[model samples]
Target: MSKMSASNLKLLQPSPPQDGLACRATDGALSIKTVGKIYDPEGVHVEALRDCSLEIAAGEFVAIVGPSGCGKSTLLNIIAGFDNLTSGEILLDGCPLATTNTSPSPGPERVVVFQQGALFPWKTVIENVTYGPVVQGVMSRAEAIQRAREMLSRVGLKDIESSYPGQLSSGMQRRVEIIRALINNPKVLLLDEPFRAMDTVTKSASHQYLLELYSATGKTIFFITHDLEEAIFLADKVMVMTTRPGYIKKTLAVKLPRPRQYAMLAAPEFIAMKADLVGAVHEEAVKAFEAGEREMA
Candidate 1:
C-alpha cells in the first residue's frame, strides 16, 4: 500500500487514553468564537485574551504569530483543553469541548509537540516512539514497533532506532520527535515553537522534513512561532494576534504552491507576504512594549 493509504489505515486505530479522558477523534476542525480568558489575583482582574475568534478547517495548516505576552499560548492552551475560556465557546467539528474546574482534557485528537524536547534520555529512538501506544494498550508492543519503524523510514531516518537521543544530533532528535507524534495519527498537531532552540542550519533541515511529512499525512497543523518566514513557509494561512488581551488582528493566506520549494522563500511574492506579516506583528509588538513601560512606571 502507498504511504498515504497506510496512513489512512493507521488513522482507524484507536486513540490512547489521556488523563482519564476517553479517547475520541475528530477531523481537527476548530472554531474559536468570541473566546475570552481572564485571571484574577488578589482582586485584580487581568485579561489575557478578549473576544478572540477564528475558524480553522480540518486538514488546514495554520500558523499564528504575535507579540510576546499577547495570549498566544493562552489561546492554544484553551484549544488544547488545558484551560477554559471565560466567555465564548470552542467547538470541534461543531461539538463543544468540556473542561473541569477548568482542568485539562488532553486527549488524542490534538497532540502538542512542545518547544522543549520531551524525549526520554534513557530510551532509544524506537523505544521512545513506541512508548505512548504500547503503554496505553492501544497497540501491542509488536504493532507499535512495526508502525514506529515505518514512520521513521518514511522520514528518511534510517538505522537510528537503537540510538539514544543523547547520541543523535539536535536535528535528528527533532525528526524522532516528529515521528513519535505521527505514530498516533492525531487529527491535529500542535507545534509550540518546536524548532526554537535549534541553530539556523539544523532548523532549516528540520523544516524540510516537517513540510514533507505534512504533505504526506495532510495533518492539520497549528504552529505557533515568532519567525514570520518560518510561519509563512510552513502554513497555509498565518494569523497574527494583538498585544496583551489578545485577539486575531490580521491573517495572510499563503499562495505558494505545494511541494513548497526553498527558492520560493526569496521570491517576490513570498517577500511581500513576509512584509505584510511583519508589519501586522510589529504594530502589536510596539504596543506590547509600550504597555510594559507603563506597567513599570
Candidate 2:
C-alpha cells in the first residue's frame, strides 16, 4: 500500500481518550486564529508567520516541526504569551493572549522549557526548581523546598537536589529543568527542542521518561522540534510549517498506538507518515528558497 493509504488506515483505528479537566469556557483550548508576525520592517522585514491557524485540544500532545528558521520558536513564544502577534490572535482555552510589546507577562499557569535547560547556575537543583513557587508566593520556603524534593524524586534527581547546576551533566540538568516545569503543574508545557543536545541513547531514555511524566500529569503539551522522527514519536498531531514566512503547510495526525515504543518506528504505518511529512517539508523548503532568491534580485 502507498504511504498515505497506510497512514489513513492507521487513522481509522480508535485510540484511547486523554484524561483532563474540562477546559474553561473563557480559555476553549489553545488556538492560533489566523496569526501572523513580521520582524524588523526594514531589515529583510521577515514575515515569520502567515495566516496560521491551529487548535490543540486540552491534554493533547502537538508537535510543531519544520526546517530551522521556520518560525516554530516564534509561534511557541506567542502561545506562551511572550511575543505579540502582528496580526490575528492567539487564544488559550477561549481567552485571547494579551501581552505588551515592551513587557511580557510571566503567566502563572503557562510554563516554557527552553532548549539548553535554562537553570540558574548559582542555585542548587532544589533552589532552582522551587524558585517559581517562591516568586509567585505559591508556598513558604519550607513548603517549596519540600515540593522541590518531591519533584526531584519524581524526575529521578532526588540525590542531586543539593548540587548546583554547574556540578551536573547536561542530561541531569535537563532532568532538573523538567522537574521545575512539572512542579508548576502548568496548564500547558511548551518545549523547544528540550532534548536536542543529548546523545541518542540518552535522548531515548529521556523520551520514555517524558512519556511517563505526561501520562501521569495529563498536561497539554506544545512541543517544537526539527527532528521528524522525534515529532512522529511524541506528538498526537504534527504541524509542518513552511521554510520562511512560516505557515501551516500541513498537519498530520499521528494515529500510531500508544504508549508508543521505539519498535513502532519499524511499523509500515509509521514509515508512511514520516514519508508524507518529509515530502511536505521538502516542498515548502523549495518554495521558500525560490522566494528568497526573488527578493534578493
Identify the leading candidate in terms of lDDT. 1
Task: For candidate 2, list the clashing residue pairs, or say none.
Answer: 26-94, 27-92, 27-93, 27-94, 28-93, 28-94, 29-93
Model 1 residue runs over 4 Å out of place are 1-26, 42-44, 98-102
True lDDT of residue 76, candidate 1:
85
Residue-pair clashes per prediction, in order, are: 1, 7
Q: What digit string (tens of lDDT, one per residue) describes model 2 on residues 1-297? A: 011232332322212222544434233268788888889856867889888888888888999988777899998888777777788877677776742343446575778888878999999888898898788886788987887776566556778888999999877787778778867667788999999989988888778777766666667889999888999999899999888788887899999887888899999999999999999888877787787789899
| Predicted candidate 1 versus true structure: per-residue lDDT over 1-297, tens digit per residue | 013344543443434545666444347788888888898879888899998899888889999999888998888888877777788888777878643234558766677787888788999999999987887688899988987877777666668899999998888888888778777767778888889999988988888878777876677888999999999998999999999899998989998999788899999999999999889999999999999999999
* Candidate that scores best on TM-score: 1
